[model samples]
Target: MNNWTRKHNKFSVQNRLTPTARELWQWLLDEMPEGSNEIIDLRDFNKWVKRTRGFPHDRKTVKSAAQQLLDKGVLTQAKSYTAYVWKWRLQPIRVLMPPPFRKPQKKLTFQSEIPNLDPSNPQPLKDEYLTTTTDLEDAESGEFEQKLQACRKAGIYYYPKDAQFMHGFSLQEVLKAIIYFLFNRDGVRHPEGWFKVCLEDNWAGKEKERHQLRVQWSTEGLFEAIRYCNQKMGMA
Candidate 1:
């Protein structure tokens, strides 16, 4: 067996070292050889934990902790190798003592006062006309049904309802049901009116107003409405 020395005091789970995880780390340090950059087998660490630390640890625990330490810059793995080695860059174990108490962070609150608003600023025009049209032709022609099905399997609902309708259902209830499945059932964002137009024009809407509206619908309203509708339909 390799001889090892304590680089730091044993970390405690109860005494402010309560990260719970660092306790295991302390155990690892206790078992490690001093001033040496040698590969520590996970099996050895587990055995050490079981015997000296009186803790129940398995190979998985050792592996997970080793990986976590490596990720946190506490340990470094060799290049072109699978095993991990401790980084000598870590401060000497003496710094592992309990941290000093910090004052609790203060929560901030604000009070609002009503101010008179200027109504002279003109607002942009609200255009109801769609810049692009819904591409019912391709969707209705089973153009992307496979993709739709894959999305369904992945629980990514919220495709256009026409995709379902063209598959052989006409009723509004059925339409709503499909909508529910995509938006509510799988939690996908539904295409808004602008997106519908974009899809119809193959995503070539010219008017800025039309484009802006579509963007809004696609981002804000579509997904939520789909979710709400799906919930109402008991799909979710």
Candidate 2:
């Protein structure tokens, strides 16, 4: 039998392996050669389910089990077209070994006397930068009225200076940053390609993909890129 055939047959080895092992075997076969370390497209698994007879319900169950295996260091997920794909590591699974006991590293503690600020040379408080708009209605309302009426008196107004600091980046900039980090920095091309496909597919037009991208990029991508560039070029 070929590797795929052998793999498929392994699923039907009734009494040879435990129930959990059999389930895991089937799941791994669904992913094929990509089982442990390489990424496999989830859509492929969905298609496989449709093709197979007597498939398990709660389709997410397989995914959840795969995730559990991943967490246990038994599998790794790689980025595929608009989704995380599964890959199986080729390494032999070793039985859990007892952790060796060792002395904990001593924690270093230090205390410094607080420097007294000179009254004559007192530093001025830096102005807070407005990041997000709290309320459109309050913003349209006069500042004085907002302060008086709103419980959260911290009213919104456009701060051109602060806005300039976080210059509204174009979508190209976002895509470039994602590509540079995923491909250039991390040497992981899968995520970069996935993102490109996502944009091409207009996945953002659909709420699901768009929201996921926005959240990931806004929180992790932009933050990391800004920090990296700042550190490298000494620009705050």
Q: Rate the local accuracy (lDDT) of all candidates.
A: 0.40, 0.39
Per-residue lDDT of candidate 1, residues 63-120 (tens digit) = 5655555555444442324443333333234344435454554333443243542233
Per TM-score, the best of the predicted structures is: 1
Residue 42 of model 2 has an lDDT of: 50
Can you write out model 2's per-residue Cα lDDT over 6-74, one digit (the tens) per residue? 222222232233223224544554445433465565555545544532233245654654555555544
- Best by the lDDT measure: 1
TM-score of each: 0.27, 0.25
Candidate 1 local distance difference test against the native: 0.40
Which whole-number lDDT from 0 to 100 does residue 233 have in model 2? 94
